[model samples]
Target: MYDVGTRKQALALVSQGLSLNSVSRQTGVSRAAIRSWRTRLEPLSPRSEPCPRCSETPRDPDDPPAYAYLLGLYLGDGCISPAPRGVYFLRVACSDAWPGLIDACAEAMRSARPDNKVFRVPRQGCQNVTCHSKHWPCLFPQHGPGKKHEREIALEPWQQRIVEAHPWDFVKGLIHSDGCRITNWTTRIIGGERKRYEYPRYFFTNKSDDIRALFTDTLDRLGVEWTHCTRAGKPYNISVARRASVALMDAHVGPKY
Candidate 1:
């Protein structure tokens, strides 16, 4: 075998496209030695450093890297006001993508304007448990005693209102309920009923922010401008009757009410 110098030259020649055996012969080095030298010269990239903030990279299927970044806002002052108030949308349990979901909701809340704090609700369920924020648990508590397989259940007062108030204005537009007769809401739009032109309806939780998107869309469809109101006071009947009575007097008399 040739000395180290010849082996190095042989490897250089092979790298330049000279045949391995040809390189060995020209440089007086063995083909095997040239092969070994060539392998050693291959470039290597720098090793990556671990992320500094988190000890472990989150591995839950629902927690995408993007969501982790978004959720970071909640841990900071950007979204966490001293005593924030709003109708925040929250997922109920630790199901699929709980972390990512929380991240997204937290991001939306942080971005909301100061005066409009009531428009969103901070979601809750598992306190520190890693969970998907998207599929939030029911906003209202269970009606009856807690059990694995409960037989019957009832709606909360607000939940009942959402069901009973055939049609409601979210302040943005009409918010309604929908479910098969077998489900609830005490009505059906089946065969014979289909003939009637029914008003549009939708389901929303006590949390108004959760249904903000629905409110925005409904207003667009009805060609009406609306503002989001988080509180629910007395029913719309009182307001509707007063407006109607004022209109009746104005038409009969002057423009005065």
Candidate 2:
């Protein structure tokens, strides 16, 4: 028999959109066993009503701007854990250097569920915006084990609707968390004279190919062009260096803060 922890891990993997075969291979469990666990642990049907006090009058899942932005942030650097009783806790980790982002995350949580208390927990080099809400798992069913690259990160149909409505906000949240805007410079000799020109660009780095695909898809929808490259011994990157593409991103995502 699988331990409770293993069962939970397997359920989480299934929640993250992993196929039965993939979960079985990763967990060294038989596909039949994983399938049975999924049937037993996951809800057989979607709940008709939101959890009481957890997300009473839950925010509209289709609202694109703020909620989608927050969802992006959550998917990038957030986690959900079991709290006291049966409640779930949601926490989004932000670097100390970006106070705006920290505040934004806190505000977003409050906006999503006004009754829930949102606060920050300070660590060595980062601060986490945390709150106790029973609806966290409902809000972010994407919660799972390990890094995003290790699992499939696909959005549900409802989430896809929100993202389709506010692709820019989604991009904004994504870039603010896992991407950066910077300046690039190159020097060349023209007419026996050295000249240097600088240009602005955006770089988004992530280990998850699915997440990267989502980012690129949004860029594509916005008519922005980008290129893929990799840093030595680092994650893959999608770079937007062309003037037009940078301008487009600037209009949508802008600077981190």
Candidate 3:
């Protein structure tokens, strides 16, 4: 890895109106690396806009409902990390199978980071919705140095309050990311005739016990009945098979598009 001084020198030369090729040749750094540094090292304040969590008078997100949803998405399949300079990137991955889910993720991120630009990066079968800003950590206090499952994930008091108020939004976000609605079928004989029946249920699977608890706690508050099940011989699934609870989910979360 190049030293910080090397990166700074290269950035300085590029700032002086030097073409990337000229900067690369003079500094012996690859043009691609120079371009990457140029984008991250630009003279921009992480707080070009007022941050709700970090402004002079700290407050909750302007759009608490959207933030609640985004929080669930983060816990399910999103991450925040330091970018070059003082910037940080927040990214949420959505499967291509559900293009509408991708759009929803983008909308939530836009709502959360109204001042920053949102980007979509395509992977083999998924799209990553991301934004760059310095205040991601301020909003997501649960962020840390390891896999979410490996760490103890707990919401700040403020965040818990938001979730309490917008539990459906939070549940939808998590379901869209790491949960699904599926049909389970069985055959039974009735009156000497065999009939096939199907049961609609919702399943939320995550390795992190804390995340699972967060989900169940919200469900409990909402009076939605749920139970643990072993799927594929793995005991990481939370199943909601009660007809009333399924109706609640259908009315709110629905099948992910």
Candidate 4:
């Protein structure tokens, strides 16, 4: 990133038709690092503000259980869905709606009873904010409001088998999750001066309350264990949480479920 004088320059070089790997090699940054830098800088470009729909101020670490609250609201009605490629934000609504929607989802999550909560962040474009997050209408044009074409759904044979094997259970047990791109910084103190270097971070959601228990129960019932990795590459490791699913069911599922 330091080597590029302007984003246009970087983008041009990237678009001039070099593979990301090739671009990274020429630029001396890892492809992942370049991608992270792109996520940070793209939104703040001279022409655009960071997407308000996807952007939110940092939460206070000392604050009370705001984490679950934020997660719940964000997951609204708590269902998970899949993308043909992976999760990514859609450009439907004005970009300004990001933070309020983020907050709204949090409020919804905070007040909902434990059994009703769901989390469904997928492994691909989930990091794309506007694309994958339900706050925007479906990106599949045919499936958008008033259109008849439905979004293509995915459930690998294994996932389908797992879902099928758990038929007797009741809580709609499945993997629940979502994630955000965060940049981590390392600060070094030298002679009372601090300098920070950034590393990309992934903020992933786990099922709130009984959702986790239900997921574990369901998976146990099915005799299957699930593993998940964010498209952004973060991993959830707990035995119970690991086997869970994302709760983004369908477009209508948010307001009602």
Alpha-carbon error at 73 in model 1, in Å? 13
- What would the per-residue lDDT of candidate 3 be over residues 1-257, giving only the tens digit for each residue? 77878887886665434588988999899999988776764563344667799878899998999999899999999998785677788888898999988988888889888977777877789888888777999999999998999999999999999999999999998998889999999999999999999999999999999999999999999889999998687668999999999999999899999
Give the distance in Å from residue 155's predicted Cα in candidate 1 to where it truly belongs.
33
Native-vs-model 3 lDDT?
A: 0.88
Best by TM-score: 3
**Model 2, 115-224: lDDT tens per residue?**
65676877789887887666877777787777768999898777787888899888888887888999999999999999998899999888888988999998899898
Cand. 1 TM to true fold = 0.18
For model 1, the superposed segments whose C-alpha errors exceed 4 Å read 1-80, 83-100, 107-201, 204-233, 236-257
Task: Assess the local accuracy of residue 95 in candidate 3 as a C-alpha lDDT between 0 and 100.
Answer: 89
- Badly placed stretches (over 4 Å) of model 3 are 1-33, 36-47, 231-234
| TM-score of candidate 4 on Cα atoms, chains taken together | 0.20
lDDT of each: 0.31, 0.78, 0.88, 0.34
Q: Give TM-scores for every candidate, taking all chains together and pairing residue i with residue i.
A: 0.18, 0.74, 0.85, 0.20
Candidate 4 or 3, higher lDDT: 3
Query: Which rank order by lDDT, best down to worst?
Result: 3, 2, 4, 1
Relative to the true structure, candidate 4 has a C-alpha RMSD (angstroms) of 22.0
Report the C-alpha displacement of residue 95, candidate 4, in angstroms.
Answer: 8.7
